[model samples]
Target: MAIESVVVRQRVEDLDAAVPFYEKLTGSTASRFAFAGVDLAGVGPFLLFAGSDEAVQRVAGVAATLVAADLDAAVEAATAAGAEVVMPVQPTPNGRRAVLRHPHGGVFEYVGPS
Candidate 1:
């Protein structure tokens, strides 16, 4: 998989509550989207997320979201490199996503159209 941009995900207590701070921090207004019932806003290179404890926990510690040219290939490459799949490939607003924990214990999300 050809890696592209990486987006960082930040957990927040409240979506609306967090927007202005991030807007000022990034110098860019956020574009909102929902994922698995979680309210998310794309603010610059960061994905600010807010939701239930369970939902937040589900994605917690995913240090970065890696964009790729091909989602399947990315998953394959990750698995082949001994990364454990935290979640199988799934649909998202931008494309498909899969979370993985590398053998060394680093966590990340991979995304791409296909």
Candidate 2:
């Protein structure tokens, strides 16, 4: 068996504020969608949404994780694009990784084999 990909979904309070930051961070434009009264933006493996606080709370602290080819470069790019470091890049028992918060509030982790 094989797993294809993962999509981490987050709910935001403001869709407008979320889109630009994600677009910049991912270096990809958001493809918008409407699902269950929420506005969504497909940012790489993340599905960022804007809706009620109650719904948003459901996924709090859950982050989208990606395996990067160049962990340092990825962290630099994310920072340059406006993401704040949630956890500084460091080596773990498993590998090297960094956690960042998108300007819109969604968190993500970038990991790479070292």
TM-score of each: 0.86, 0.48
lDDT of 2 by residue, 1-114 (tens): 122355676666788898888888889888886543556677777678777766554334657666676788888888898989987888754468777888889787677767
lDDT per residue as tens, model 1, 38-113: 8899899889999998887777778899989888998898899899999999888877989999899999999888
Q: Tell me which residue pairs clash in candidate 2.
A: none
**lDDT score, candidate 2:** 0.71
**For candidate 1, what is the TM-score?**
0.86
Each prediction's whole-model lDDT (CA): 0.88, 0.71
Model 2 scores worst on lDDT over the 10 consecutive residues at: 1-10
Cα RMSD of predicted structure 1: 1.7
Q: Which stretches of candidate 1 lie over 4 Å from their true place?
A: none
Write down the TM-score for model 2.
0.48
What C-alpha lDDT, on a 0 to 100 scale, does residue 84 get in candidate 2?
96
